[model samples]
Target chain A: MTGVTARRRGRPPRAESGDTRDRILTAAREEFSERGYEKTSVRGIAKAAGVDSALVHHYFGTKEQVFEAAVEVAFAPALDAPDAVADGPLDEVGERLARFVLGVWENPTTRKPLLAIVRSAVNNETAAAVFRGLVVSQLLRRVAARLDLPDAELRVELAAAQLVGCAMLRYVIRVEPLASADLEAIIARVAPVVQGHLTGP
Target chain B: MTGVTARRRGRPPRAESGDTRDRILTAAREEFSERGYEKTSVRGIAKAAGVDSALVHHYFGTKEQVFEAAVEVAFAPALDAPDAVADGPLDEVGERLARFVLGVWENPTTRKPLLAIVRSAVNNETAAAVFRGLVVSQLLRRVAARLDLPDAELRVELAAAQLVGCAMLRYVIRVEPLASADLEAIIARVAPVVQGHLTGP
Candidate 1:
């Protein structure tokens, strides 16, 4: 007879084992979101995850790593953005980029982690460094490479500033009608401005 | 000696007192610019001014107050931007706005306090709140009022995003060649884009 699967296997089953890592990341995200970088501790993430603090240390090594894991999980969707914008026609590039960015921000799944990261950067040195690294390496560098223009890097940087600043006002600061306007309307009005920065005379 | 000499008394004394207030504000601006909000303390401002800490506090009740004083000093020039842009023909509006903004950031006297406030906002909730309040109340709201568009507020916000984002990348992040380029060239390229967001098709 097939023996009952051992409740405590030598190691946790692979499928279920991955769940622990995910849970820890989720808990860390929540803690960081609510408390910010300086206030968030590894022990707090463990408590929230309902795991031993040592288990958290065992898996992530440090609070910064835990934070990094949370950021990676949150920003995972954005990694595809370059491909999405790059695949589109040259003229429609701005609209496509704007839509992809707005789409990421509009989704609750992504917005929470983004808000957390932005808030932390505004209030912590460590978090700001991480944010700068992610934006520079992951997002801006790709866009800069794609643009063929004088001061292409500056154009990309300007595009990023415009995008991020708009998001900050709309979502983080909740400044007026911007926070309440339809996403498509925003795209139509602002995308070309960004496009102009990227490709205009 | 008899009765006090008129030259040394009354109005001149008041003028000297005004000079002290100006001196304190100037010193605070330098301190905040060089050291940022968190690093620059009350004592530091006082020491820089060669005055007592209590006098610094006496003139400005708190560090936040000192920051406010410094911002008022730095932003007085920028406050005129709306009027300058508004007075011009709509076609030239973008160029004018861009020039004014770039001029402010490029000026060492202004850039310091502005940078301090921005850097502080990234790491201090109080600072961020103050910044949000200033931007929303002073800048965005004014721009929104001037625009005759459907979503005027959103447009203003988008315009602001473009402006502030460029500043972040060029000045704060100092992203390469853009940071080192000729001011007029940068302005010519970016202003039209910003203008489009403010008053575009």
Candidate 2:
């Protein structure tokens, strides 16, 4: 333990590595948010994080990988739906899933990164590909496995589509009524629809 | 008629001006698609249309107006929802609406421009604002006026969100199963849920 602490001020294989990695990831997200994906560079991220450029590469590899990391974090809370499903009644899974997914967008912190990633994904084919591979599909697979139905993945995606679409209109596109509506009121209206998609015949 | 025929070449007077405007709009759309919103310019659209830059500005006023024209065209198909609602049985209004919106994406010509405008909206705030003010809200207001419910606009937007979200996955994000599923099959499954949002208890 002493040697681990003594060997480096900012090297790998110690508790500091975790802190350093998180610092770099946070910087990467902020850079992506402020400068966007096409303009934000590894060097810019390194500068923002106050670390050497080599260190960012050492931690997260390429710009694409770094963006993927941001998507991972952006999608983390919504990705927890399956675990929540594990504990709830099957019929009410829709409410739980809807509440969980919307809850991510409800919070200002997680929503900011999601906004950045969706914008990046929208404008860039490579970013879109990374987003396609990383977030929703990853969440869908876990969800489909838990759902245990014949057309499990399709059903889950339809449900996911409902939630994702609502968020886009409310948060991203900022359509009225839905945009300014009460969160629980939306949940009340939307949960049954989500439940229907997930469990209805 | 004789004076109209005698007008100078490429100078707008009557029939030619409509053709020229359409040409400029087509050129603007292609520029927005290939280069994106922030990068695409009035001069670029003029150049693509083989017209003078002054002509583009004279017709559309600014780059923002040009993008709005593109959004207007892209959303034209989905914008017909209110008309369909007027004719159809209210119980099946959801199916008609879903089929209308999704049908736009199903066509290659319409889908291409929708993709372009959405990508533009995602990357540029001006484009998003234009989109918000011009397209979906405009569609919702017309739709809400027809629905004749207590929370008509909110109900319309929720239904719109489902269709929009489903399109984003199937057409934009290209998620599997739902992405590859049959159109009618999707219509069958999604219509009921959309109907519930529209007119369900």
Candidate 3:
């Protein structure tokens, strides 16, 4: 029976290591970054990863799921931010949040996917819905829960707007001067304002 | 010959009465508000306006152009803002600017398109690019030119970020409390911050 099964198989089973998954993710990130989510397809990702299309589907059920995974991977640094904020002095929360968020944008490895999501969210409803869901559910909800204030939800949402808007101008739009300014300079100047929005009376 | 042609046309062959153009603009505004820029197509706008699809093409060659027209129509109030700022005392410029901007967002007629653009800009590259061009060239440049400060450009951009961020939270995301709060109260609270950004030391 084993011999018959081996004969029936077209080729030896490929290595089942997680390397293929990582490669697929990396390829997906690149493809999504270069071409927004709508333009990117599973076949494109598979071709980029040098893997079978079926393998891509086997690993990730749908393109949206793959896109979500890519976003999560890109936002991995941001995902760790809650722990970092928890570790730091409560007073320094605003500064830490600013630094962490800015750091993600400053890092090339993450910026591509971040930019892709931002660019896609502008024109694509599905992408916007997904992005909005991630922001509201994952990021804003946690930040809001951590805050000890009246209207905490509103405050957190506003704080997020401040940070996201700064990011939109500085990184996504690449507006002059703000775009070229030193990172620390920006962090120092903007953190207090964000802090004011977050915890201020 | 002109009279004969006019008679042959049945109606007086009115000089492209802006009624159709106005209807398309209105429909486009609603479509964009409800469906956003990417999902709302020319055909959809035409259908909504009860006009032939070809009329949409004849009126506006492309979706981008239509979007531009829609923005211009929607933001007619904002386009007057620079002149308003330029006409007023420089000292009150910040407060006036804030009032004008918040007022626009507070008005339902204007707020919808503004919200649509903000939401769309997040995901669409072309839309983002167009938004950046309009903001930088039309709005920020004008404001910067009016400022007597040393780093007028940076100041204008920063002030813009503050205002845009506030609007992003208050409207598009519908952050509670602030979203439902009095506009004058917000203007009073944040105008100074904007003032500081624009003219403060």
Candidate 4:
């Protein structure tokens, strides 16, 4: 009902602002990517978005908040992927988790946000905190809840170590062979390893 | 060996400069750690070392060369571990590799340079490239040579991904449980995963 009513309005106020907010965030992502966390600023992001400086602050509050919001938007889709991954067969959870996460890296859209996080997170404490919280509390916790094991969190983290490391080399560091290897080949070789971390003896 | 003559020198010109070079490199590593790659400058590094900028340039040509030299020294001890690691029992290679690599991170001395690289590599292309060269060409290649498999190089990288990721989480990001878990506990849980990546079908 809310959706229908909102759609019916001529130049809906909320939707219009929502569009503005999205525009600012998109600009913020680009700014951070090009200049990094420390060098990027609200005024610059606002200028890039073609919005008033006050309005940028009004929408995002602060630069840190802007970073938080931008990553949240970028990571939104990937966060939902593992939301459903837990209900499947226990035996194949590793492949499912590995593929889904790596699949996010494989896809350009999801890859950009994660790449931003991975890129910025290394140099800045704020970025690293945000990345850790998102991967652990939001992403891994959802997966861990399904395992119903005592050491599920540790297991999940170790599994994450493997996946994150591979992605770092292949995508971030852009190392040879693995960086260019077929996605399926990596999935085949890496899936079982991820599985071992998730459910090994 | 030449070691005796070097030790016997009364202010040997070579050893005196070697000490100075070590001091400058130490200052450079500290600067990189604190300010990151982009914000760091050769002038600032020289200032920290209490040396003339000309001497800094004399010893290490540019900022990039300084970074390469700093990480090379920081990683010097670690670079040697895998050199001998390849000669060990193949089946136990995973445990030995994991223990040694993670051990490097575990030791405060070796960990500092690695921490600098991991922290800086995310945002800087040069740092990432240098780290990739060191870890791949210098470190993983040695271990891969011993595997004698067509896919050995890829396999070794995968194993590195796992260890590197775990170290990132544990040491850099400082994620809980895994970060604070007893070192032995991490090795016990993570070694098999590394083994799987190394030799699994």
Candidate 5:
């Protein structure tokens, strides 16, 4: 404890490593948002963060790693999706998912980075690959595992496709009616479809 | 009939405007695919077509118009979607839509330009707006109108979201399981959810 307080102000202590990591992630998110995956470089992100490129390599080893970290942060809320299935009644899991996924897009803070990830994933093969890995392995598969039903994985993916498509149109593409429609009304219509995927015969 | 016989092959008749238009659209799709919307210029497209830029201007007034024309060509198959709703039994409309939308992505000839449009729409705001307009006005709204039900538009949009989301994952993002799954299996799994959206109580 004494060593923590005794450190000099000029140099950042090891404890500040978390802050440095976060600053780098913020800068990376901004760069990826502006230029996308192919055009963004580690040096560029480091320069934006006022850090050495080597330091960036030290924390996040590669551009893919950096992008993955950025995605994790962007999708932090969505990572909680499995809990929606875990916590709710099986029949209502679809409604919980529709509400939770849409809620992420409706919130402005999450939407910015999400738009970047969605845009980058659409345009770049590598970004899409990484995005797919996270969505399938980390998010959707975990949700599917809870269903204990035949074709459970397919059902979850279909549900995911539905939710992802809705987000693409309503938030990123800004398709009207759906884009400006009431949130609950959308949930009311979409939840049953999702529920059918989760529990239907 | 005399006018049809009067046309000669040299320099393409003035009546051959349709062929010239198709060539320009093909070139535009290629350029937009390679460089995306912002970086793609009329001169670039015209050069690719082995024609003068003025000819491109004569055919399509602006870059936006050229892009719109390109979208129309790419979405030609989907333009028939209204008929899918119209020709099918009301109960089977969902299966018809799921099969038709997925079939567009499955066909190599159509997928190339559709991929370009999806990639462009995701990355560029102007492109997304144009894409949203065409999808909502030309495709989804027309399909929605045929349903004799309250909130038909919203129901159709919800179904579109699900199907579009599936295509985004399967073709655009190339997410697995969904991407590689058998076509009939997917149709079987997805149609019910779509049917529910269209005919749910």
Candidate 6:
């Protein structure tokens, strides 16, 4: 199903170019989630998507490109999260940030891919570097700039560490007490520490 | 070798039972560090140690047991770290904990196996559960007990989250600036957040 049949016959296809690309990305996500970044292959993704390997390469130039695209698609919902915290008063920023992140993970649709990314990123070097770059530049630094506090960068990173650590424990590792604890309770307990990092004396 | 040459056919060996176990553990550490928990096998460890696979099975009941033993051996240096914080004044506990944990990671010798464990734990469910159990019950809970504060368990866990998150970024993920930052400076920036978790209003 390399589209060889469609191309040779010169027939109008049911799926357009955009649909094929989407299918490749969806397949890539599934592959990455199941096997992780290191073990995932372009050929595997292409086969899963019912396309030729060349087509996958055509849509995404490289494996890294496809992974980057996958990460972009997976994390799209939280791209605005830093701004969400930025618009709020300084004191309440921590709670808002916590809620936004936990809410993203708590959602059924979003959590699947994100869980894969977080789990895979930790084990794979390339994935970790990509994830680190996005988190630091896109999410953490942006919030740090808005705070205008001394050690602003460090402060925001520490806040991120808290929340990210919480996510790792609760969602990925499934650490108990924290994992099974009520969402609001965790927010109440964790927010103050984050706030301290952001604006404390 | 199966210790056949080292052991006598009719007499007791002089090296003692503990020496054999220690040798097995050392080999296990090397294998686990290089290949991680999932890929490392008892046979591989036995081959590396120049012992028969039966010897490994004899010394450690199973792969999980060997891994647990390896973790214990690897983390032995920092096993007392929580108590080190527990012995100090409440206000300074955060600094002590941060300094101790970071110091362990910053050292070349300790960081290797810990890195393997952290990286492997994220991608593998069994490893994650084992790691979660050890960190929570053995490390974090001991410190939480010393706090004697309300929600002390949750509080200590949150503190653990922040430090664990920082470790994930600085060591495993290699997030820049934070990764390259001076050790004491990070301690200065992170200690307060931990303090808040441990002693916040």
- Provide per-model DockQ scores: 0.41, 0.66, 0.31, 0.65, 0.79, 0.59
lDDT tens readout by residue for model 2, A1-201: 878678765565767788888888999999887666887899999998899999999988999999888778766666666577535688888888888778889999888888787778767768778877876666667767777999988888899889989998899878787889999999999999888887789
Predicted structure 3, TM vs. truth: 0.75
Clash pairs (backbone) in predicted model 2: none
| Winner by TM-score | 4
State the lDDT of candidate 3 residue by residue for A105-188, as single tens digits. Answer: 899887888888766665456766677777666766677677767677766665666677778788876788888988887787
The digit string of per-residue lDDT tens for model 6 on B92-144 reads 88888788778888999888878777766877787787787777788778888
CAPRI accuracy category, model 2: medium
The list of candidate 6 runs beyond 4 A from truth reads A1-15, B1-20
Candidates ranked by DockQ, best first?
A: 5, 2, 4, 6, 1, 3
Candidate 6 per-residue C-alpha lDDT over A1-201 given as tens digits, one digit per residue, 9 for 90 to 100: 869877866645655787798889999999988878877999999999999999999988999889889878878878877788777797898888788778888998778778667767777778887787777888888778888976788788778888888888888877777788899998988887788788887
**Model 4 ranges off by over 4 Å:** A1-10, B1-10
Candidate by candidate, in order, the iRMS in Å equals 2.8, 1.3, 3.0, 1.4, 1.1, 1.4
Looking at model 6, the pairs that clash are none
Q: Write the per-residue lDDT of candidate 5 for residues B5-55, one digit (tens) a residue.
A: 665444456647787888889999999987788779999999998889999
lDDT of 1 by residue, B1-201 (tens): 645676456566779878888888888888776656767798988888888999989888999988887787778878777677656677776677677767788898778778777766655567777787776677666666677677776766777777777786677755556567777877777777777777876
Q: lDDT order of candidates, best first? A: 4, 5, 2, 6, 3, 1
Q: Score candidate 2 by lDDT.
A: 0.82
Per-residue lDDT of candidate 5, residues A1-201 (tens digit): 667666654365765887888899999999998888888999999999989999999998999999999889878767876666557677788888788778888888888778778878888888888887876788677778788876888888888888998998888788877889999888887888788777777
| lDDT for each residue of candidate 1 in A118-179, tens digit (9 for 90 to 100) | 66665566776777778676776777678776577777666766787778667765667777
| Native interface contacts retained, candidate 3 | 0.41
The collision pairs in model 1 are A122-B122, A122-B123, A123-B122, A123-B123, A161-B165
How many residue pairs clash in model 1? 5
Error of 5 at A121 (Å): 1.1
TM-scores, all candidates, are 0.77, 0.88, 0.75, 0.93, 0.90, 0.88
Q: Residue B99 CA error for candidate 6 (Å)? A: 2.2
What does candidate 4 score on TM? 0.93
Q: What number of clashing residue pairs does each candidate have, in the order they appear? A: 5, 0, 8, 0, 0, 0
Question: Can you tell me the CAPRI class of model 3?
Answer: acceptable
